[model samples]
Target: MSNSQITAVTELDRSHYKTKVYSGGHFIYADEPTDVGGTDEGMPPAALLLASLGSCTAITIRMYADRKNYNLDSIKIDLAICKEEEMNKDTTITRKIEFTGDLTEDERQRLFVIADKCPIHKMLSNPIKIVTS
Candidate 1:
């Protein structure tokens, strides 16, 4: 498998009433004064998820623009996730992607469609089999 496809494991340490999480070959601690016991120094998992989507969207747009030879100065994507009362009965994730740059109408629409084709977006939208022992 490719390096990006490799599985990773995290080990947590909780001795003397202190919590620490080790993952990606590094150690992370909960944020101080928050008491959530997450990476105090690093971003929480949920934040990381949102960030991943945003970053992927931006990078995907950039790649598409570069491939098309579009004179794109920059690409910014604002992502937000919210739960809808009726649709989120079982807890669903809803994301909003906003693109900002100098592009024609067609390019703008095409890029939006391309954003949905991102690797991470595909993985999240599709179902996967998880095995645990």
Candidate 2:
């Protein structure tokens, strides 16, 4: 993999937890729900994490299928993260994939394997350390 670094910046004001995120010349909003004292303007932090994984998985599968000349129409991914009550326990993330295409059972199984090959999935499956300065 190329040694590339991605930098993202976020700004949060007194607007009840609504945050502005900027990366790669793009911008998006992250906010908490109204019940949590946010304006509910956009996806929360947890949802954003799942969105990243889902998009990466779908893109990886699509690229693989196209490269191998598989009859792939579309890909749908559903992801949910379950937080553990005990802090020491690991959190569970459930991902369900649906494909609309003409593929054999073997191909389907291979796609399942390919899903795990996504960069985000690999990153999440491994150990991560966040350093704050």
Candidate 3:
């Protein structure tokens, strides 16, 4: 984020949707399930999107818990993208968060407020423009 922008490179050969993605000093693979004509090597793109949001939500809450001196043992986040009939072409992400900690209801409520401020959540909630040539 400090660099203002991030870059990643992905290469796809003849292996259907299987692809290798390289980002800075890190690398990952993206693949579809065999039921969808892929080799089922890795998570599909949509899953990665959910993973990003869930991880960010957890990390943000953990940071707040540590700063507030709360006993936060673990955080579980479940994310799903669903399409409702009322909203056309709109993707709705259902995020279910579970917290394991010794804290008051106020503290837990604060975490719910803080979760929305995560970087990924902010990015996805706002307008996005992707350019390709």
Candidate 4:
């Protein structure tokens, strides 16, 4: 098993809903929108989630293509989260992937399969346990 840690800190005096997030040696800010009593200084939580998944999917596809020597030029991923209370169902995430370069249909299909193999995708697709102290 592999473990990684990230820390998020929020100071009310600094902003109502802005948080400082530290992961590895990287730092970023997360905040809600201004209408939600935030200063809109950074991406909201849902946007961050989509960003992670999209990036992971792209990287996973790129790595596989490169390893196989496929003519993959670039990858673009679009992701969105949707929740419907009217249907009384769980939240759904939609991901659209676009690949550029000369590739056969078989290779493209296989790449689609590889996208789901990304760590973030697998983690989100399975049941997760969050233990807090």
Candidate with top TM-score is 2
The TM-score of candidate 2 is 0.93
Stretches of model 2 off by over 4 angstroms after superposition: 1-3, 83-88
lDDT agreement with native, every candidate: 0.65, 0.91, 0.88, 0.86
Cand. 4 TM to true fold: 0.86
Query: Candidate 2 — which pairs collide?
Result: none
- Per-residue lDDT for 14-94 in model 2, tens only? 888999999989999999999879999989998999999999999999989999998989999999986424324378789
Candidate 4, which ten residues in sequence have the lowest lDDT sum?
A: 82-91
Candidate that would win on lDDT: 2
Per-model TM-score on C-alpha atoms: 0.69, 0.93, 0.90, 0.86
The C-alpha RMSD in Å for every predicted model, in order, reads 4.3, 1.8, 2.4, 2.8
lDDT of 1 by residue, 1-133 (tens): 1357434454455532234555667765433324644435655555566777878777887888899987677776665555224544354455665555577989878888988877778877777679989
The alpha-carbon deviation from the true structure for residue 16 of candidate 2, after best TM-score superposition, in angstroms, is: 1.0
Candidates, ranked, lDDT? 2, 3, 4, 1
lDDT of 1 at 87: 41
- Residue 31 Cα positional deviation in candidate 4, in Å, after optimal superposition: 0.6
